[model samples]
Target: MYGFIWRHLPGNPWVKALISVVLVLAAVYVLFQYVFPWAEPLLPFNDVTVNDQ
Candidate 1:
């Protein structure tokens, strides 16, 4: 997958690297801004358990 992205990016090595970084940041931003918020309520990790003796 990474190799496919690297190949598809158009430019010299430096330009490709910059574009790759920008793309990664954009993906992360989208995940935090939309995907994670949408999925947060569906996750079960917020439930707490305790034992009393």
Candidate 2:
């Protein structure tokens, strides 16, 4: 899959590397800014409890 993307990206190695970094950053930004926030409330990570036995 990654090989397919690398082949489709325009320009030589340097340009391709730059574009790859940018695409990764954009994906991370979207996940953190939108996806994670939307899914957070649905997850059980915050449902913590402690017993003093």
Candidate 3:
């Protein structure tokens, strides 16, 4: 799969690197901006809050 993807991408190393980075950023943007915000409220995590009451 990695070989196929690399082969389809740009031949130049610099151009391939740029495309890889852009692809990653695009995925992250879609995940964090669209999915994570909605999923975070539904999923639970430990909240550590220190309060002097």
Candidate 4:
């Protein structure tokens, strides 16, 4: 798991940071890209509503 990787790659601080950042970004990308798209139709937005007069 993460502990094993952390122990084995203890000497590479840069690699650890890069991997952590990539993993965090990937999770965010997946949430916004896939999960948000699925709910897009359920939400609503109006650039010009009745009050726009």
TM-score of every prediction relative to native: 0.90, 0.90, 0.67, 0.51
- Per-residue C-alpha lDDT of model 1 across residues 16-49, encoded as one tens digit per residue: 9999999999999999999999999999888988
Instruction: Give candidate 3's TM-score.
Output: 0.67
Best by lDDT: 2
Candidate order, lDDT descending: 2, 1, 3, 4
* Model 4, span 1-53: residue lDDT tens: 97886667644889887887887899999999999899887778544457655
lDDT of 4 at 24: 85
lDDT per residue as tens, model 2, 1-36: 999999999999999999999999999999999999
Worst 10 residues of 2 by lDDT: 43-52
lDDT (0-100) at residue 28 of candidate 4? 99
> RMSD in angstroms, candidate 4?
4.9
Models, CA RMSD each: 0.9, 0.9, 3.6, 4.9
Off by over 4 Å in 4: 1-11, 46-53
Candidate 4: Cα lDDT at 5: 66
Identify the superior model by TM-score, candidate 3 or candidate 4.
3
Local error of candidate 1 at residue 10 (angstroms):
0.5
Error of 3 at 47 (Å): 8.3
For residue 3, model 3's alpha carbon misses the true position, in angstroms, by: 2.9
